[model samples]
Target: MRGVVVAAALLLAAAGAAQAGPDLGNWRVDAASDGQVTASLYATNKLITGNGALGYSPVLTLACRPDGEPRWSEWLQLNDAVSASRKITMSVMVDGTSKFDESWSVGPRGKLLVREGDDGIKRLVSANRLLLSWRFGLLSGRGEADFDLAGLSEAVGQIAASCNTDPP
Candidate 1:
């Protein structure tokens, strides 16, 4: 626990970045299910806590340094109903405003999808902690690559709000 805290601090320092309006504080996940799955998740500043029934033990912890850069990453192991983890790399940009994120996941599953332009909405589904389901252009496939949209959205919002409040 201590090591993770230190590492998170160091990562923020080395990057010298800030997230969205939240100021890059530790956020927690609040989720519930049939005493075995996550149904809701909430993140806070002081503690990145999470409550759920799934095996999603890891909650993304973050720390923002106004003088340095800030970065964070966490893998969510989906069990039963969904099995996936996203390793996202992002930056708060020295100026803070917009954030750029790219993630990759691999698993099993397939479906049909309709192709769309530039920013396409891909639907990823999982029934267990080992297989994954995703929809592409009029087709469905399975692999070990996935993205955490919630995390990305939070990160981007934080930076955007920060910039609105005070630009770099």
Candidate 2:
């Protein structure tokens, strides 16, 4: 019984040390086709799930090159020659499950430059612990339901600071 208790204590201590931020909150955002967009992120246990919605106005511009290569810009510029609008839709799940689908090039649209017709890539960074709800591209163009990242981060910081153990 004493050994079991010691093992349990060790596990609990490990868990406490693994927490990313603070609150086990959620982040959901919505963006209209008008060009404006909203992004949100939050902490849940040691995991953080968030949302990033694109809007209609203010347009979500993509001007970055692939692999930070100069040729990437030229390739993307010429990508227009292959397809029309760089319009795309990207979705990310709470468990770091996300996908990106687009026509022409992902660089101009998805921003991650995923293969065409392909859904997206989802990788478990840390034993389902340290998740990365990140996908550079287009999400929703109207609205959505989830937690906000920017706000959640701020909130987590406050909460995590109060905790004796530091949040990741």
The lDDT of each candidate is: 0.28, 0.30
- TM-score per prediction, in order, is 0.20, 0.24
Error of 1 at 135 (Å): 30
User: Could you give candidate 2's per-residue lDDT for residues 1-168 as a string of tens digits?
Assistant: 999999999999999886754453443333335422222233332211223242221111111121222211101111111122454343434434454333334454432222221012112111132222223324422222232232334332343343322223
State model 1's lDDT. Answer: 0.28
Q: For model 2, what is the alpha-carbon lDDT of residue 166?
A: 29
Best by lDDT: 2
lDDT of 2 at 58: 14
Q: Which segments of candidate 2 are over 4 A away from where they belong?
A: 20-66, 69-147, 150-168
Report the C-alpha lDDT of model 1 over 1-168, residue by residue, as the tens digit: 999999999999777754323331233332223221111222221211123332322222222222323221123232222223322222211123344443433223311111211121111111111111232222322213222334433443453343332211
- The TM-score leader among the candidates is 2
